[model samples]
Target: MKSLLDLLKTKGPRDAREGAESNLFTTAFASKLAQGQSAVPWEARAVEVAATRLPKSRGTRLLQSVWAQDPYMSHLSSDRVDRMQRFFAFATISPNRDLIRQDEYGSFMIVLLSGTIGVDRRQPWGEHLRLAETRPGDILGEMSLLDSGIRFSTCTTLTDCEVAVLSAEAMDEMMEHDAPLAASLVALLARKLSLRLRVVSSRLSDNPHG
Candidate 1:
């Protein structure tokens, strides 16, 4: 089970981007700018144009914010913060309703930036069972990112929503460059996972059927 970084490294340089599970930048309008495609979505077009002007440091900042907000970030040293500031890439996703499905590759760390999303498990009886509502600042998709596992459940937006995505490679880079930050991040991830497990356990105790 190779991590996303290992998978990316194995690709030919030209094919790196193509290997991504989702085109975080591909919006409705990028086709219009293509050689023969028409009517590219403006939002997609804007991301393309913005990509050229934004500096790498700015991208790093966006990712740092996600890391800092994690309860685990409290353990990080200032030096680690500086190192994190040095590396990392950021991308945003604004998916339409029910756009992302279950059992997909859990490739990135997603921070809910806005709106609401429902986390649910499909059951033998029906779908939409064991649902949890998530709001801004909530971190999702981490279970799979920290471990090479498929998505544990489905996440569907209740309204148009935004998510900040940071690749595993970027996270690995942060760890290599800043030991404290890496430790802090791992601890943060652990804490979040532990909390989530407790929540699940409590629910099960209340109603094992769930």
Candidate 2:
């Protein structure tokens, strides 16, 4: 993926005189930042800190898998990825007994870099519904972040872990800059949903009430 700084210098332009196609993508992408212009002080601060500390590309397999299967990855030219990479937020979570639910953090994607996490999809009747055990190379919280929808499950750490977080605003800014990336992201969203559907289908087939 491209770093955020690279996107600014290479993808961003100084004026509208740049060719219409180039300008179009750049302009659209820039609009995201402008649209959030009225952000509160804390929000702006969060953006700044996240942007500045966003991880630099390390050519890891997990990243490579995401780029390969994620529809949005293809839309982003290497130049764009280099630029977008800059906005990534890095986080580390140690193994704990507590559970993390969607209501706590708004929306974000957690990429497991190490260890594992247990996902429990809550039932309508207020009961724990075991989902999947996520490990390194797995992506958690993507469903909510991708669609700007509510989180579907609760995640709990099983071991010390590190993860990459991509928030909604950051995602919006990245998409605004590149049309292809937006299209790709939508595709990725579809793929993920389809996979989940298949899993659900298999479960239903095996056990009618499940």
Candidate 3:
């Protein structure tokens, strides 16, 4: 049987023009999601963060400490963490914002530096099913981030949130410039994803109603 990494890695731009294709994907993806498509709407109201860029040197050690404790993230050396900090864009998002909306096509994933997010699914008959709530050091939308797939659940910030966003463009650049670090990152993300899926499977198997 194919391992989970093999299954997840079977995703990427379907064409040779990596830059053009990723740009087109993001532009169209954002435009479509803006025109009234969200698991919950935040973009249509023009709440999009106007600040597009952030300095890399801010709050380094605090985030570094948190990452060092994560089982998968611990594999990254301090140098790799420096590389990651330089690569990712940091943002402070306010409460009640949707970091990810179900079924929207987006090219980035969020790493929470602080605050809480609720991950939930909207059922067919109009009820919201809470899957999990995330905290500091947690990652949101990474499955889609890795595979460029549609988001399976909506992730909404429940408090003022600080995040590091890793974009597809950044990922591609990383892969080109630092192949080993990129491989480590992909492996790290894959292991985290695989662990989550295993926990979910275990829960479902244990549930009498499931």
Evaluated with lDDT, which candidate comes out highest? 3
Which parts of model 1 are misplaced by more than 4 Å? 1-92, 95-100
Top candidate on TM-score is 3
Question: In lDDT terms, how accurate is model 2?
Answer: 0.52
* Whole-model lDDT, model 3: 0.67
In model 3, which regions exceed 4 Å deviation?
1-55, 201-210
Q: How do the residues 159-198 of candidate 2 rate in per-residue lDDT, one tens digit apiece?
A: 7665665665565555445535544554555566678769
Clashing residue pairs in candidate 3 (N, C-alpha, C atoms within 3 angstroms): none
Q: For model 2, state the Cα shift of residue 66 in Å.
A: 7.1
Arranged by lDDT with the best first, the candidates are 3, 1, 2
Worst 10 residues of 1 by lDDT: 20-29
lDDT of 3 by residue, 100-127 (tens): 8887766778888878989887666666
User: Relative to the true structure, how large is the alpha-carbon lDDT of every model?
Assistant: 0.53, 0.52, 0.67
Q: Total clashing residue pairs per candidate?
A: 3, 15, 0
lDDT digits (tens) for residues 79-122 of candidate 1: 56556554433334344444234665434555665568788777
